[model samples]
Target: MEKEKAHESQNSKLTHENRFGLGSSEHVSIEHDPDDLWGDSRVIVNIGPTHPAMHGALRMVAKLNGETIESSYCQFGYTHRAKEKLGENRTYHQFVVYTDRLNYCSSLLNNVVYAMAVERLMGIEVPPRCTWIRMICCELARVIDHLICIGINAVDLGAFSYFLYGFHQREEAYTLIEKLCGARLTTSYTRIGGLMYDAPDGWEKEVKDWVVRTRKVIDEMDRLLTTNKIWCDRTQGVAIFTKEDCLSYSYSGPNARAAGIDIDLRRDQPCLFYRDVEFDVPIAKEGDVYARYRVRLEEIRQSLNIVAQCADKVKKGPIWSEDKRVKIPDKTLVHNTMEGMIHHFKFFMTGFDVPEGEAYTTFEAANGELGFYIVSKGAPRAHRMRIRGPSVYHYQGLDLMVRGEKIADLVAALGSINIIAGELDR
Candidate 1:
């Protein structure tokens, strides 16, 4: 009880507000006579920062007529961390740790894209095994991300059983990630020239087994909720956005694809081993919450297929490039050779410098497009680093999407978009 109290106290110091969709410092104001306006009147309902539905650090102000929201206003910057500024101050090698925090659910993808941007600036190409392994890591991240988005969205809509079904699969996938890299979430597994280490022995076989099993679980989930009357009624035709709205809002990933956009970085701008692997980018025409849900469901299957294929292709080879400046020497070599020892020490202590250049690399992340823009001026750290998160555009469209939507449907719409606050406020 004392520990719980201390935790709550720490959170209170940050934002002393949260409960049943209201902020502690905010208030309720009733205008005019309640009886006279009982039949018809607009009330200003405040879904404050402390509200249970809202993240304690964020808020949504919705103007509603009875149970339906006539208009909506989104409040942001509640959890800004100046992550970009931190990237500018930190070395390329050191900044790998911060990438994990950007999209915490799929940190591997974040690590890969950031590394790719830096690698491009330096004109480095990782080995074949490294490329295949990176593909597997990305697909694993995709499955885990989609599972959480689908499960939590279901839970938010009162379908608790479905959430558990998807969550079990997500946990199983995390175990595989833990095997590949020491940690599961916030994985700082990627390095500038290659991965931190090679994939473990027989790792592909275990991943293949999981892929087949996960497909079964996803199939069952689709059967459970795809055609369910409750889910359909709750999500279908809600938060509809046309292709024009998607383009205007600069939306990407599943949300934009649901509205009939066909651009996926993997296909449109193939990089790594994506060109060699075959996968489909799911699309829908409705542009509603239900369409977004369907797109994610199909995407999970496609990601699994990619993972299975990559597993078969992965073989014994050098994981890191021969780039001495960027590659970390093996532990055995460092201990046996003096030259290896000094190189490793200097690499970490002084860090490698890239020629003054800039590059932008974008990947088709679990939710949408995740890009990194890196500028170097012969400095150990980046001159400037910019993160292009899909959440920024999706959150911008929230006020428009939720207009005329019921408060209940707002939760479902937000979930389908898969807006991670860490990335949104970075």
Candidate 2:
């Protein structure tokens, strides 16, 4: 009884201290909404953790009046795995694996961002071929992710055939990814200075074949949904947000593109091999769900174009640099030479040291600006690492979109936002 009381007292004291901390109490109170105690509202609808259209374990308490939403509140943390806390305990390389969990639809991009940020902090220079390969693979991932988003949105809007067709193409893309990397969904293929391994022999031909097949699939998807009267009626002019509004909310990628903001990190920031490549950024004037859908579909074409360019420009060269500090020495050399063996052992065990600096690297992810902010205290492991996820921003804009719109449109709006809960909760 005494121990229980002491425990409670300790918790209370901690809570009191936390409440008084700088900006902590203010943020907590806003998130918790203590005034929601009465549960009194007109036509309250709870769409939730178990709902088919909810995507992941997310709940939205919406108040409506005859097909018009008055106000809405989102509930998260159901799928939270304490990713930030988990990063603190793991080594730099081990943390790369955890990044696969965030925005699992485009896990490769997440891993790339994490690795790139670390590389920046470490001042490690990757090979040109590796950078180009990362760009190509991440662009492919963007297309795959958009297919899921647009197709799923169509499904929610009662177009089942489109979903099947899109997913079919996505599966083909997945197979290609699986062939390139050992794993499809969770591809930790990227290392500090280069890939885990070079693209397999004849991988270029495989990429070409997939591009041809995907172009056909894209044509079929367009015919099935893009020009269909039902699809147009359901999506056009629904859940609109302007360019200014999106910018104010820190929106990025397709969401921003849909609002006529022509900002693609690949073009504007020019990271990796993006500067050498040529591709168009598709933009739509209308910020409706349909506009977002159209932007994504057009983006698939751009990605295919980039893949073709990469295939043509790609040369037979070393994928990894000759930096012993960043990359392990060749196995043949390690076995035959003492110096090579020593270099390999040192890299694997101690890892390389990073410069004492911070860098913020942003990439054009499937959803939006997937950013990684890393602060290195001159250690192999980062002093601090933060992920800037699009889903969180998308979730923040949900109330604005859903309110005053039909309950049925909720699913369409949510799908268009492409709020993968993994990214949101993380």
Q: Give the candidate number with the greatest lDDT.
A: 1
Clash pairs, candidate 2, are: none
**lDDT of every predicted structure (CA atoms):** 0.86, 0.83
Score residue 70 of candidate 1 by CA lDDT.
83
Clashes of each: 3, 0
Which residue runs of candidate 1 sit more than 4 Å off their true CA positions? 1-40, 48-52
Looking at model 1, the pairs that clash are 17-50, 18-50, 21-51
lDDT of 2 at 426: 88
lDDT of 1: 0.86
RMSD over all Cα atoms, model 1? 10.2
Residue 228's C-alpha lDDT in candidate 1?
98
Per-residue error (Å), model 2, residue 133: 1.4
* Cα lDDT of model 1 by residue, 316-370, tens digit: 9988889877988788989999998998888888789988988888999887889
